[model samples]
Structure formats: structure tokens, C-alpha cells
Target: MLEVKDLHAFYGKSHVLQGVSLSVGRGEIVALLGRNGAGRSTTVKAIMGLVSAQGSVRFKNEEILGLKAHEVARKGIGYVPEDRAIFPDLTVRQNLVLGIKDPRKRGRWSVEEVFSLFPLLAERAETAGGVLSGGEQQMLTLCRTMMGDPDLVLIDEPTEGLAPKAVEQVGEFLTAVKKRGISALLVEQKLSISLQISERLYLMGHGKIVFQGTPGDLRANEGVRKEWLEV
Candidate 1:
């Protein structure tokens, strides 16, 4: 559903993504794994047109390399940034309402469906987003993105600072996403979750994809893991 080829992105004079290439098939969950400075987040940002990027970014065979962030989002791609970007003052329900691209048309996701998936969100429906816990904020961001009815989502560090229980919740969220036939490009640091949920995984090093294979393949390749993934 999504393909990136020879993608290079820069931050001022520093080149962060160097010829990075990867693909996500329809309804598949692909994980991108690496150390802190391996440029994994930059890859997703470039794809979302949030940075200065060059090369080819195609969704369903159409090039979207130069499109603006909002334009790219309108093309059925949603992004959940590493920093949970929720409106602090808005109520949970109000924040979700903003994610609706069109109120007149019903999309694949509904507020009720999101509430069903995460009951904690339902309990906090009328509460201000800023007062929620970190885990709750994360869940809210994910649900808000789903409200846009995206065909694919680029999620960066969904489990970065959460507790084990919250991490499990994120795993459940990903499973729900796949069950609904939504594609995901997950940038995650937790190898256990990535290996458990992702059909395929890509290991990045020095701003490039050094290994791309199935979870089993990654498990069997100790050398690759030690070099590119293990800290």
C-alpha cells in the first residue's frame, strides 16, 4: 500500500535519512527498529511531508513526495507523531471530533467504536486531554487518527514511556488496526512487541535500512540484531 525508494531527508545541512527504502503491504503491520539516532522517526516525517525530502514516496502507485502534510493526509494517510499531539484544553470527545474529515459522511471508524476499543477513553470522554495520564494521552492520539478514516497510519514511538500494562494496550490497539484491514508503519523501540505483532521488520542503521525480513528471519540472525538493533 505504501512504498518509499531512495528517500533522503535533511535537517538544515545535516542529512538524516539516507537512501532509505521500505514498503508496507495492504493491511500489514511493518515495524522499523533502530537505536535512538538511527533516523527512524525522520523516515516517517519525510513520508508525511513534514520535512524537506527528496526521492520517491508512493501510495497505491502514485507519487506523493512533494505534497504538503495536509495534502498527504487527505490522500488517506494518517500520522501519529512521537510526541502525542493532542489539544491540551479540549475535551477528549472534542479532540476526536476534530479528526473527522467530513461530518456528513461516515468513515470506517466511529467515536463509539474507539470508546469500545479503549474503555479508559470512554470514561474520560468529557475530561480535558491535558489532565489524562501519558498512556491515556497516547490512546487518545491513536483514536483521533483513526477517526480520519485513514487507509494507512504512520505511528512513531507509540510505547516509548508507557508502563507494561499500557504497552500491552498498545499491542491490542495494533491488533485492532490489523483486524480492520488498516496498514501501519510502526516506528518502535520495543523489539518484543515488534517481533510479536509485526509480520515483517526492518532494522535501520546510520540512516539506512540494513536488514529487512520476517520476524523469524530477524530472530535467527543474531549478528544483524547485535549490530543494528541490540544496544
Candidate 2:
């Protein structure tokens, strides 16, 4: 559903992405795996037009590069940042309401649907976002993105900073989200978690994709893992 071809991005004079290219088929979960400073997040930023970039970014056969962030979001793309940017003062429901756009749908997202997916969030519907735990905040962020009814969601490190049990819950949540036929480009440090959920994997290093294969192929290829991902 999305294709990034020979993408190049820069922050000031420091070049980041160097001829980076990858693709995410419709209804598929693709992992963008790489160590820190490998330009994984920058690629997502460039695709969303959050940063200036040179090259082509096509989503659902339409060019996305050079469009504003909101414009990209309007074209059926949603982003859940690594930092989980929740509004500190807004109630859990209110924060979700802000992220729930795409008025073409029936009610965007019914409160029942959200609560069903995240029972914890349901119980804290009126609580301020600042008071929620990290795991709760993560669930809220993902639920808010889902409320937008996006075809593709770029998720950056959804399980980071969570306890083991919470991490397992996150993995389950992603699986459920994917079952809804939403394509996802997951940028994560935990290869095991990503492998459990993604159909394909793209191993990146030094701002370029060094390996692209199925999850099983990636798991068996210890040489590539050692050279790029092992730290």
C-alpha cells in the first residue's frame, strides 16, 4: 500500500536516509528493523512529510512527499510516535476525540469499540492523560490512531518502556489491529516481538536496507543479525 523509493532525507546539513527504499503491501505488517541512529525513524518522518526529503513516497498510488503532515494523515495514513504525544490536560476520551478524524465514517470510532479493545482505557475514560501509566498511554495512543480509520499506521516502538506483561499485551493488541486489515510499518528494537507479528522484515543499517525477507528467513539468518542488529 506504500512504496518508498530511493528516499534521501536530511536534518540541516547532516544527511540521514541514504537511498533508503522499502515497500508495505496492503494489509501486511512490515518491520523496519535497525539499531539506533540507523535512520529508521527518519524514514517514517520523511514519508509523512514531517521532514524535508528527496525521492518518492507513494501511498495507495498517490504521491505523499511534499505534503503537510495533516495532508498525509488525511490520505488514510496514521502515525503513533515513539514518544506517545498525549495531551496532558485532556481526558482520555477527549485526547482520543482529537485524533479521531475521517468524518466519513460512522462515528469515527464507537466508544464501545475502543473500550472493547482497551478495557483499561475504558475504566479511565475521564482521567487526565498525564496521570495514566506508560502502558495505558501507549494503548490510548494506538486506540486514538485507530479511531482515525487509517489504512496504514506507522508505529514507532510501541512496546518500549513497558513491563514484560504489558509488552505481551501490546503484542496482542498489534495482532488484533492487524487482523482488522490495517497495514502497519512497525519500527521496533525488539526483534522477537516484531517477528512474532510482522509478515516481512527489512533490516537496515547506515541508512539503507541491508536485508529484506520473511520473518523466518530473518530469524535463521544469524550472520546478518550479528552484523547489523546485535549490539
Candidate 3:
């Protein structure tokens, strides 16, 4: 439901995304695999109007390249940054409440459903969001975005820092997102998790997509993995 074509973004004349192109279909999980500085994050941010970009960012068959960030979000596209952004002062429940633009405009997610998915959140519903651990904060961020009820989400490194259990929780969370009929463009460094969950993967290098194929195709291409994926 999201398509980015020849997207190029700039940071004060320093070009980051060099003719990047990709797409995420309805209910499909597409992983953008790359190392730091590969422009994977820029691809998503540019699509969301967070960066100075010139290209075609189409959502649900409508072009949204030059729209403001909030305008882009209003069109049913949510973004979860690499560094978990949670309210420091608000309670967990209150933070989630802020995600809902309109309580009456119930889309696909609810507070109860989010709490059910992460009981820790339910237990700490009244607790201050800033006091939670890194993993808990990650869960909170993802849940809050779900509360917005977007059709597609751009998640940047959801498991960047966490214990194995929390990592697994994130995996389960993505599965639940798909179950709710939401697609995602996942920007991640972990190949194992992406390979396990994503139907297709795109590897970026030097600010460009170097490989695009299914999990099986990616797994079989050892050269591509070595050059673009391996540490």
C-alpha cells in the first residue's frame, strides 16, 4: 500500500538517499536491511516528509511526497523511530491515549487490545512512561503507534537494544500487527529476525538498494549477503 520511487533526500546538500525505490504491499512485511549510514532510515523518513526529499511517495494510490509530516500521518502512515520516543511525564495509559486522535474514530486498534498484547503495559498502565526500561519503552512506542490505527507503519530498528526475551516480544508484536491487517516497512540490522518474518527483503549499500528478493532468494545468495549484509 506504500510505494517510493526514485526517492532522493538531502541533509544540507549531502545526498543521503540516492535514487532509492521500494514498496510495501497490503498486509505484507517488507524489511529494509542495511548497515548504519546506508540510508535505510532516510528512505522511510523521506517518505513520511521528515526530510527534504524529491520523489514520488504514494500511499493507497495517492502521491504524498511534499506534504507535511502531520499531513502524511493523517493519511494513515505511522512512523516509529530507531530511538524509542515516549513521553517522559505522562503515564503509560495517558501516553497511549494521546496517540488516538479521536476516540470515536476507532480504526483497528484499542487500548485494551494493546494492553492484552503486552500485559506488562497493562500492569504498568498508571506508571510514568519515562521510568520504564528500554524494552518496555520499545513496547510502549510500538503500542502507542498502533493506537493511531495506521494501515502501514515505518519501524526503524525496533529491536536495537533489548534482552532476547524482549527481542522475541518484538517479533510477536510484528506478527500481531500483520494479524490486524497492517503492513510495515521494517528497517532493521538483524538479518535472522527479518529473514524469519519478512516475505521479501531489500539490502541497501552506499545509499542505494543493492538486492531485492524473497527470503529464500536472499538466503541462497551468499555473495549478496557477504557484501551487503554481513558485518
Candidate 4:
């Protein structure tokens, strides 16, 4: 339910996104794949209005390009950055509470529901976020964001820096999110994990989308993979 059209973004003259266009339909998982400096993360940030952007961004068929970040979030979008910015000083419960909306809306999710998705967070409810391990912090950050009850989530590098098993857990978690009818715009470098969780993939190069297809189609297109994604 999100559409970005010919989006251009920059960081004070260093243009990072050039005519980037993509769409995530309802209950669909779309992976945005590219190497470093390909502007995948910038695409998400621009959609959130975290950076100035040119072009059209529509969420639920409403124009959202110029809205503030919170305004965008209020329109049923959640973002989990690669850094997993958990509040170090806050307890796990506190961090989760921060994502909770007041006077919860009809379609909103609750803390208990989020904990059900990440039970480890429930066990560490009282622990200080700073003292948690990297995997735990990542889980906490994701759980915190889920508490927002978003219609669509933009996740950046959910598997980065984690152990192999943790990466698998992230994969399963994303799969669960998909089954729950949550749409995702995933930006990931780990192709295998991303393919496992996504139905469609978009390969980007030099700040633009070069290929868009099913994961299986991408696997079969050795030529496109070599030209746009090979290291």
C-alpha cells in the first residue's frame, strides 16, 4: 500500500537517490537489494521524510512526501533502522512503552501482542537495554516498533551483525510478520535471508532499481545478478 515514484534524494549536494521507484502492495514483502552506497536506506529515509526528497510518495493512496516523520508514522508506517536504536538507559519494558500509542485505535496492537512475537523480550522486560546482547537489542528494537501497530514496516538490515542462528530467527520473525498480513519494505544485503522472507526482489545499482522480479526469477537471471549484485 506504499508507492514511491521517481524519488530523488540528497544529503546536501551528494545525491543518493536517483529516480528510485518501487511499490509494496498490501500483505506483500518487497526486498530492496543493493551493495553499499546504492541508496537503499536513503530510499526508506526519504519516504519517512527524514530527508528532503523530490517526487511523489503515496501511502494508502494519500500523498505523504512532505509530511513530518511522526506524521508519516501516524499514517501506519514503522521504521527499524540498521542500528536498532534502542534506548540504552531505558528498561526493555520502557522502550516498548515508548512505541505504544495513547488512546489506542481500533486496529492498533498492544504490548502483550508484541511480546508474543518476541517472547525473549518479555523475559527481559526489566533488563536495561544497554546491558542486553546485540541480538537481544535487535529483538527489543523490532518489538518496540511493532508496538506501533503499523500497516507497513520498512526494515533495514535486520540480519546484519548477528550470529547465524540470530539471522535465522530474524528470518522467521519476518515470515511471521508476513503471515500476519503486514507489508514490508525490506532493505537487506543478505540475499539468502531476504529471499527466504520476501515474495519479490528489487535489485538496485548506482542509486537506481535495475531489476525487479520474483526471488526465483532473480535466482535464474544469472546475467542480471552478476551485473548488478555480484561482489
TM-score of every model versus the real structure = 0.98, 0.97, 0.98, 0.96
The all-Cα superposition gives candidate 4 an RMSD in Å to the true structure of 1.3
Model 4 TM-score (2 dp) = 0.96
- Superior candidate under lDDT, 1 versus 3: 1
- Expressed as tens digits, the lDDT of each residue in 1-231 for candidate 3 is 888899988888788889999999999999999989999988988988888798788999999999999898889998899998899899999999988867888868889988887999999999999999999999999999888889999999999978999999999999998777899999999998899889898999988999999989998999999998788
The model with the greater lDDT, 1 or 4, is 1
Model 3, residue 132: what's the lDDT?
96
Taken over the whole model, the C-alpha lDDT of each candidate is: 0.94, 0.90, 0.91, 0.88
Report the lDDT tens digits of candidate 1 across residue range 120-147: 9999999999999999999999999999
Q: Report backbone clashes per prediction.
A: 0, 0, 0, 0
Question: How should the candidates be ordered by lDDT, best one leading?
Answer: 1, 3, 2, 4
What is candidate 4's CA lDDT for residue 150? Answer: 86
Model 2 C-alpha lDDT per residue in residues 149-224, reported as the tens digit of each score: 8899999989989998889888988988788889999999889898999999898898899999999998899999
Which regions of candidate 4 are displaced past 4 Å? 106-108
